[model samples]
Target: MNGTDTRSELEDYLRRVRVALADLPADELAEVMEDVEPNVLEAFEETGSIEELTKRLGTPEAYAEELRTAGGYPPAPSAPTRTVGDRFSARYVVWVTGFSIVVGFFTGTVGGGRYASDRYVVLMLCAPILALALWLLFSGRVRRVDIESLREYQAARRTGRSAVAQLPPNVVEYLRSMQPAWWLVRVVLLGVAFIAALSVSSEAFLLIGLLIAGLVWAGFRVRQDRRVLPVVLVANAFAVGMAVALLSAVISDADSSRSPYVTADYRGSGLWFDGEPLDNIYAVDAQGRQISKFYLYDGTGRPLVSRGDSCEPSGSDLTNEYPKPEVDYTQGGCTTSTNMPVLPLPPTAPVSVSPSTSVSPSTSVPSSAPETAPGSTPPAPTTTG
Candidate 1:
């Protein structure tokens, strides 16, 4: 036979032997396979034919049975017959566990702020389902082997490993190096989510605290036990969800707080004084004379028009005209007045001014005129002729 045929026959023999020993504990079976494989390879290489190898070593199953007997191991236990309910229960546990974990983590992370109660309700509801799943796992009704044996699970595992294997070695190592940092990053994300929720509701403190603790524990456990990897992955997903939720909430708040008049379609018309809207303007000249009508203009000479208060029949319109008509809602009915509601005071009394006695340019006061006494009126100035 060709070398390829011989190698294939050898591999087939080893595969059958492994199947025969499958009931052994994993470590013990591995030890038995290690001892048996080299001897089989040596015998095959020497014999040069499968028929001769089988005559010397017996069939693969008989060989495995001889090894079990020589090792003082008991006979393999018979496979248990699983009922339909058993299959259903295992599948139910798997599905419920996954669903509860994902939904619970999402609700717990996003339930902060105004919807704190919603988080509690969802968690409470999921708790029983999750507890049942855990019980099934611990009770061995749904074994790890059962889950791993599933076609979907095996396919996913193969796909993941294949994808990772396709990466360059250096890139894979770089990603491995980042794994430790991700644990801390997820914790920080949880903290950010907590603070964001706390800004709107104080009730998120306990929920976020528990999540942070779980993340820390999961990180630690995963380092020691690779079986905890699924837990770590779920925690990472939760952190990503938290970050997305926080970003969306922040954007929503910003949009809400923005002024409605800040949009492209906004056209501001009313006048404002010290942040307060002005419905109308009143103008008066320095002499307190009421200026009946006047237009306003800005520094650039743009008409500073505003919608003035309009009486019922007169619709509101933009105008720069000042002293708009006043509308009064009295007990009788609405009344409109174009006249100034507040009358300007009559012009102040004019100061009387007697004309100063004419002083001729030729006339001059004597420089040596005597100073006047305190209370006495100065004697009529004597003519200094």
Candidate 2:
């Protein structure tokens, strides 16, 4: 093969090794790329062909692995799993769950014959997040960066220090000074996400709790398993999706069927239907306070006309036999549109008897007055004119 062809092949092989180790920390990756390229070029020079070099050195990935092991590197951290099958399965679950959450949000917003604009809002909110997730999954970033070796990461760190040293001293100091602020920012972000997830729905308590547990587990295992980041990404996506959906709900002024206040769900009485009064009736507001007039809609959202009426009690005499006056409802007449008003009990009136008619207790009482033996005849009564 021509020198140009050999060099091109050697470059391609080195590129593959770089790609394989791309998930390593940035400094570590740079170190690996720097180390691998020289060795492959030297091998290519002796072998005179890419095929012969590969046969002697193995595939680029295998070659990288050998180099990593010989250099005392740790195996690349991965998502906490045993095999590729487990890794991909977990990723698939994450994707499905994310999409499900988005769909659920949309359906929950507009499921019950809601306004068309609400559907549009749902689409707008979810489409961008889904598109980004798809791009992350398929663009080879998540799929390609899983396997790495951490040997000689110390050297990588030294290189990072050197790079930082090259920056202006003041710039470096400024960055160092911001470290605490950066940590605070991270804490605040996590705190907001956690609070938002818990606050969004009582029904999601278990799910949110599980997600927090997973996050904690993944955090501890992240350095050992490269796939943990993918899991974290998925979890963060779910959390952010929930937060967004909840915020949208709050901001949209959507009427909630389950509002804590009864006033929100109060439907006017069936006094009117379809922009006309069903019958001549007085209207009251949601608080049960009477309104001279009110406009309302029926269950099907048809507008109804309201009638004006006096809520005050009428002047008609209420007989004690009935205990309440019966109201006569007619056009331009007194009407009782609400529950009956409770009337106060009447006061007792003092009774007066004429002195001439007064009788002593002994004379008036049958037991005490004119008590005689059963055998004795009763005295004849005399009448005074």
Candidate 3:
């Protein structure tokens, strides 16, 4: 038998011994102490002296053990009890750790290199809302049915297992099924699951949050209450920030016009040859590329309008406005519109300048003049002055 379970014979003998030696109390007590003390000192097996023996007896606990052994008694039993608060705190720690991991992973993934990615915004904005909804649904109404509310439940008494199970399904499951084997599997699954869900949504945190909310909702119905509001709330918060970033990106992305907001012509001003058009004049080659070719009434075939460097737009010297339809009188050029005047010279009329005279002729002529223009009569010719 264990020493703690004292035999009835030993107890009876000790009591009879005590009663039989009743005459001299001090001597009796001394005799009992002497007999038992040596036995205690011998148990350790190396007692040099009383001082050594007393030193070996560390404290009251050791002394009590010695007393219990000498008295032939069983050791007093300990209380087998745990408080509710300690259990609740342990569960809270696990839940918070798991939830933070999920939230942080999604926030980074969905934000991508830039949260401007449209899909990321969608996911980040919505995830939180989904979490809150799941909490409300699973927690069962705004007011929780705490044990305090129950008629039979009392702070004075221990609460029943059924009452604890009445907590959110997630809480119940954690308390009930949180075995080491299951926890190992869950931590791995959840770690990967958080990543997979975030990745699967293409880092679209809002969408992933929405998807998680659905999962949370369904889980609550199926009694998976550990799927709490906090995780879902984390996911949803990511969704919201992403959405705001996206909106800001869109708003801030002002589309500046690539084409000049206000366009003016090239002014087409430059030097020309015999076949070249005058400054600011329009001339099309067979392919319709504007050629500077134009016929000038002057002896030298310079561009007719705005011929020299002195040539400038008739109006605003700044030249900021749309090119005004100037007659191009300085050099003589046509406007872009077809309805504008045609300045073609006939071949028959030749420009004659007196080589002796410095002045050149003013007008041009057609090379072959007899052909009729569509609706016009031929102009009368003037004799030289």
Candidate 4:
């Protein structure tokens, strides 16, 4: 082959070596390539042929393996043969992971009131499944190669590297330095989540304890075993989801409590008395005669407008008018009553007068008896049967 063809073959060999070493850190891979390119070029020039170079240096895959060993790197992971048991074990892990995600979502959405106790039971039941998954992971039943080969895993790995590469070196270093702090933070967050879970059901204390233990174990093992990364990510995702759920629940409760009586736009403003919405207002004169129509105002003289109920066909318009028609709906149709007096007024009692005191025609007697002069004892008032 001509020199150009030999150079092409040499380039192809270097490409394969780089592909083999792609899993290495970017800086380390670059260093390895720097050392590799010079040595390969010199060897190719001396050999004068790609065939001779292959015979001397072995195939690209073998050469890369030798370099890995010399550099004290882990050997390349081999694709595991998918025997029936291995396939079953892998499927089991996948199903358990999916189950965990579903349970997490469910707990986040309905983790209160009557459902709280049930959630703890569900969590307790899930402990065995989670423990089984951990066992499989630690026992090597689920191969690391299988995880690395997943399309989502590979895509995530590439995306993470790309993102890190885009960041400034100082920023990256700062992030790396904060990793230990992050581990502690995540543990604290998980602990809080566990406490929240415990509050719902004391029965699931064991399950929560198990989960916290697993999280700590995973954190410790992640450096030695990359397989633990997915677990850590899942646990963190769950903690975040639970936090969002709790925040939403609190906001929703607050809104529900206040929404019926008041709102941001004042559209929901209504007459509320003693923590309850007042549907209607009734008015009566001093003689107990019902006043059918009247307008209400506050001490400041602003109209006391309240949201009208279904009895008023007009949309949510505020009204100060009293004695709104009481509305009731039945299967037949709706009925309304403008009944003025809902309660009966007692009979008025006659006023008593003292025989000794004579009132002038222009003088007006007070409704209540006038105070007795000085210290004189007054006669007891009589009551009609």
Candidate 5:
């Protein structure tokens, strides 16, 4: 038969099954009816008693009656397995798998993939526990189901048509080869992730791709092997995503990137990381020529700011973005970057513990030398100013 005719034939088969199964729950209907999906093309190829096939597959009342007689209504039929969340079951295995994926993403993103090709190792570790969870919540999504559930699942599958709509048989078969499709996807994502990482010089993209591939591979392996490759992958992905977000959570001195806080000035010597301006800071001209920039920091773990180096970092006449020590302020009203003596002027010299540490020091008084002062003061109507 031609394409339209073939599809028509398939739909007719499914409609017969659906009517037979109309009284069943969607889960059950989907369940007993799924069999036809795997084998409808084969049926269409033959000329035989579809009636006999339908009879043996039975009706919704018959399937429900069979299920009720087997066990009390199949107990929600275990609602197909998902990649995460409801599947977690508080298992540490899942937790660790999640942990490792994060670790791998991080390592991978930081150009660490070359360090070890052990993504599979991390995933392998996570799979068993996931498999256990799958077994506990066993349904159509898992491996090692009993003969009855398996048989019923198979039967339903055989009864359903390959395509509910007008997809070609070869196309349908190609799509049905889910494992190959998964592997292809995994490879592509990872490859793209790698290239992007190299070009953009950001580990974050690769890490993300690592995660996507890991999850895909994990799910495939877990379901196919009746094992856990995919589960670990999913967990790993989550962990890495978390790590990336946390990587930049250096608590800043303020809510905004505004100043009196930290602002980058194209001028001045670049800010120091260990007493030297960060080498990564760059400078560019109007024509975009590189000269200098500074790596400014908030003095804790926040980002290493890259303020471009300027021959004279240009800004407003009013308040310079990188102010020249508007009296050396620090967060929380600390005058010096660290606690130190601020001696008053003719020169208000800030005696500092660190160039970076800005803390306002407490007052200090010089001790009077015993009673020498007593005699001196009585004598010192002459001076003591």
Candidate 6:
């Protein structure tokens, strides 16, 4: 009975110690717990009574306080209170506006077709922020304090221990040697992801966020222990994966639009394929007359033609005053018969005649002798075989 009571008392004391140090970082809390637990358990084993243990070791609260002092941790706030609801202010307003702008730009560039459900994009972006704000507003304030010292202490301890015991000396030296270069790489990656997220589109946020989160996770882990190479690998993998995804998206769009829009060029313009004897080539000379015999050329300026099977004529687009013929060559083949509509030409200037070298005629010539002098005998025609 006495032993059971002592065990319960010891357990309760340990619980109290943990509760008191709850506000400390996870690593610090764990370290304190590890050191205190075994010592207390051993004391209990020998003493066989809670009263005797406390007489020598003091109360659990005092022990926890001593641990904090030794560990260089500040005391937690006694009356820390939670603040209900975060306010909607300039920062959030800016975030929301930026998000909207990104979405608007994306829609405009990608094909701003009206949809019955276009409102969904706005909802998706705003709802999360709104929910977070509401949560902060409704939730009561809680005690919070700067945890930098605890984190630093924990990191230092972890680094020392890991260097000596977990990793080989050569490996530790190698990691230390590479630290400066790694810092540069990290900064570059973070900058790229951040800039891309802002400039490209809101859809990039998810990818960028993932990359940033990975970077943060890896950074924290590396601070804790240099043996955390797995975290670093995973973070860099995310960056590479995101880059590949962006490239793939671009390539897919290019492949899909190859025939419809522009073709890839040596300069990598990726504009419409002007390389052809296509039917719809339109150009104007200095004289303001349309060039009718314009021809398509290869890179070397040689003519080329499509010998593919006959393709079915696609429907015509009559949006302009003059209609254009649209063709789908996916089925049969390519053709120069794609009669794209001609755009209206600009007005031409009247041909101005310089002063005549000879005296100007009073009236215009009839172009032929007047009707045989009003009934004179008609001239005979001469024929030759």
* The best candidate in terms of TM-score: 4
**Which 10-residue window in model 1 sums to the lowest lDDT?**
357-366
Question: 81-157, model 2: which lDDT tens digit per residue?
Answer: 34665355435534544465555444433322223334434433443554454444444444433322222333543
lDDT of 2 at 212: 58
lDDT score, candidate 4, position 299: 39
lDDT of 5 by residue, 304-329 (tens): 32233232336213221232222233
Alpha-carbon runs more than 4 Å astray in model 4: 1-60, 67-82, 108-115, 146-185, 253-291, 294-321, 325-337, 341-385
TM-score of 6: 0.26
| TM-score winner, 2 or 6 | 2
Which 10 consecutive residues of model 5 have the lowest summed lDDT? 360-369
Local lDDT at 283 for model 6? 47
The sequence of per-residue lDDT tens digits that candidate 1 reaches over residues 281-371 is 6755545566789876653456656555566565567676777677778746776555666766543444333233121111113222122
List the candidate numbers ranked by lDDT, top first.
4, 1, 2, 6, 5, 3
lDDT of 6 by residue, 80-156 (tens): 43332222232343344345434433432322122313432543454366444323322312111212123443475
Structural similarity to truth (TM-score) of each candidate: 0.47, 0.27, 0.22, 0.53, 0.25, 0.26
Per-residue lDDT for 1-385 in model 3, tens only?
A: 3221222223333333332332223333345545654555464347544346457654434564555566665553453233464344333433443454355445534453433345345335444544454444344322111222323323322344336535666665565566555434434433333454554555443444444554345334332223253454354444444455445555656432322332212233222234443333344333333334344333344322332322334433322112223434433553332122454544234335333221111222323112233444334434322
lDDT of 2 at 289: 42
On lDDT, who's better, 3 or 4? 4
- The lDDT per prediction is 0.62, 0.47, 0.39, 0.63, 0.41, 0.46
In the range 1-385, model 4's lDDT, one tens digit per residue, is 5433465589779867766765566446667878898888899889878889888888888889899999999877675245777657766766677677567556544543344766656655665786687677666676544454455556755787667667776787787889888778667756766676666666644555665686788788665455565566556555556667767888999989887554633433355443355667776554556667888655345566665545556544566676666666753576665555366463244334444342111112222222334434433334433
- With a 3 Å backbone cut-off (N, CA, C), the pairs that clash in candidate 1 are none
Q: Is candidate 1 or candidate 5 better by TM-score?
A: 1
**What clash count does candidate 5 reach?**
38
Best by lDDT: 4
